[model samples]
Target chain A: MNTHRPWKLSVAGWAALLLFAPATVLAHQEIGQITGFASGFLHPISGFDHVLAMVAVGLWGAVLGSPAIWVLPVAFPVTMAFGGLMGLLGVPLPGIEIGIAASAIVLGIMVLAQLRPPLWAAAILVAFFAIFHGYAHGKELPEGASALLYSFGFVVATGLLHLVGILLGEAHRWAVGRQAVRAAGGGVALAGLFFLWQAVAA
Target chain B: MRRAVGTTLVALAAIVVASPAHAHLVETGFGAFYDGIAHFAVSLADMLIVIALALFAGLRGTRAARHAMFALPAAWLVGGALGALWPTASIWPVSTTLSLALTGALVALDAKLSDASVTAFVIVAGALYGFVNGATMTPGGAGGLALLGAVCAIFFVNTILAAEVTVLPVGWPRIAVRVAGSWIAATGMLMLGWLARPTLA
Candidate 1:
């Protein structure tokens, strides 16, 4: 039990750092011609809000147990693609940035509270947020880029982030680790609050 | 476990280490083959369905996986044939979305359907995928090569997924697969809503 303390602390500390780390501005255009697979893959991972929300979705799913472990992660990219399509077609969904920030806040709070809503409820929550995330991805797509390849890259990146969350969330299997996960959730929620403030303030 | 991990590592390495010339050049002959592969690789809707079907086959265990290995490609070929005969209309995006949703739900539920039922599902899935592929792809001089490439690519992906998942240690890893299934289903449902949403008048 004593030996496990370090492992637990490390996990929690990492989650805290990830959530609370000062935001870095990514120069998507400066990256230059994000036209191929590599660029698309990097896009989702590039944004701090996207990363937090995606990871939170995974962490929350892990905490929920059973089917959700897969469901939330899977729904995100699919719905995001839909949103991306909307963006591509020039369809309007207002306040996309607000929605993206709200996702982190809301999902982070869900984890922090250790809330386990019904499966359908959870799906709805994530799906609503996914559109914004996907739309943002679509909106950023380079002119004349291979839409398919770009989407593939971002989806893969998004999946990897969810995987990270699941791996972190799996810590809940241990009694001591459960609290650690909750603490991580608190960190995520705090990050979300900061993001929300920024969104609103802007 | 080591073997599965090794296979994945090898595949990733192959992708990373491959020459750029092997990827971007669109030419005749081999280029058409590459084009075919690229088409399937990037078609999100199709890829999702293939993945869902593979996941479903994996959840069903090895027997279903075996059946899927044969049935999916054969049905795809049949679908292609039908498409060649009357390549009139493409399948609706909604249909593909529905298929993905169904496959995901099946995996999430972990229902113990009969092998025949599973095979039928795979057949339908294959044919549907085939029909779409055939309708969209222009069968030029390299059409056969393109078809072969697409089939091979799909086969490779599905096989890896089904094989690795079939061997996963039960408990946490297995539960993770089911969770993935649920996500697929949720995505499908949301896509349906997106499709149905009324546009600004």
Candidate 2:
């Protein structure tokens, strides 16, 4: 019936274990799967341009509403796959960096202005941008272990970025929140301009 | 009573960790029957393809899902049996990735497919997977029991996933599932691209 707070008990127990327990053993061997998955998952979200554009895709989709909300998400991956194939086959597309940065600017503008184009046109635009992103990432190979699992993590991370944008875009349903969404769009566009400059400078 | 319960638990644990007697079973450190289950469960390519197909069927509505539930495992079993008897090397990665991409693409699109079409799709996918899985996991006629375990695994995954998606309401939840499909498709496509990656000089 007598009880200290649960947090206190946990803290005491952890302290006792830390002070009394033997030093932890570190593994000497390389953990292949961990490295593979980490590399794959990081690739899409790692770059500034990549993350911004992907999020913008979802943001634009959400602002568009209904089928575009879903269609853009759908089209992006499938079209990206085709672009990946082209890259793998050694088909060259010029100005990949320019394309990637331009995606952020265009899509961010769409979000900022609440530009609602026809669904087909919107889908094509997103799909077109997806190609550049895919080609940029297409040549990357997981570091020789759990390659398939690596792809799973990579794709999931990319999709999660879209989910984040969609969740954020939900703010547009309200008046004040709409302003916030627009502000976020402005920030994205600014970032895109920076990226575009870097691409051109290089 | 406590000692008896403890002893029983220990015995079950021992049984679970016991080395397999059959050579056909994949050595997953889980015993013979579980090895077959592990074969189905552990391989992302096989498992995700089944998942994508089940999801696609489910999105098509209850009728298509119902057809998938039976068609998938049944075709898998028949194909597995054939493969077990006529075992060959299963070179799966490229083919598996392509198939997974197609199946996931179907789900991502939220395609409206008929019951018959769904049945055929699942049957083809299930049988092809079963053949490769059976060839790889079980070597010969002696591995019938393990093959049964694999079939059961397929049935269980298909049933649960398809059932859940069938009952999902027509909005955000459904959209979330479609998102999952796109992820699967993207992953599969990425793997395919990896196959053609430029070799370092």
Q: Which numbered prediction scores highest in TM-score against the true structure?
A: 2
lDDT of 2 by residue, B1-201 (tens): 444455455555555554423333233345656657766775667789889998999999989999999999999899887777667766465776788888887888788878898899889888888888778766533377777887889899999999999999989899888888988888788777777664421
TM-score of chain A of 1: 0.80
Per-model DockQ against the true two-chain complex: 0.06, 0.25
Mark the regions of model 1 whose C-alpha exceeds 4 Å error after superposition. Answer: A1-36, A62-71, A78-95, A113-124, A135-143, A170-183, B1-51, B61-63, B85-117, B131-138, B143-169, B176-201
Overall local distance difference test of candidate 1? 0.75
lDDT for position A18 in model 2: 45
Q: After superposition, how far is residue B20 of candidate 1 from its true place, in Å?
A: 10
Worst 10 residues of 1 chain B by lDDT: B20-29
Candidate 2 positional error at B37, Å: 1.4
lDDT of 1 by residue, B49-162 (tens): 788888888888899988887888888777866765555676666777678778978887777888789999999988987877776674444365676678878888888898
Candidate 2 error regions (>4 Å):
A1-31, B1-30, B139-142, B198-201
lDDT (10s digit) by residue, model 2, range A15-113: 444443334332222356667677778888889888989888888888998978878877887677677767766678999999999999999999999
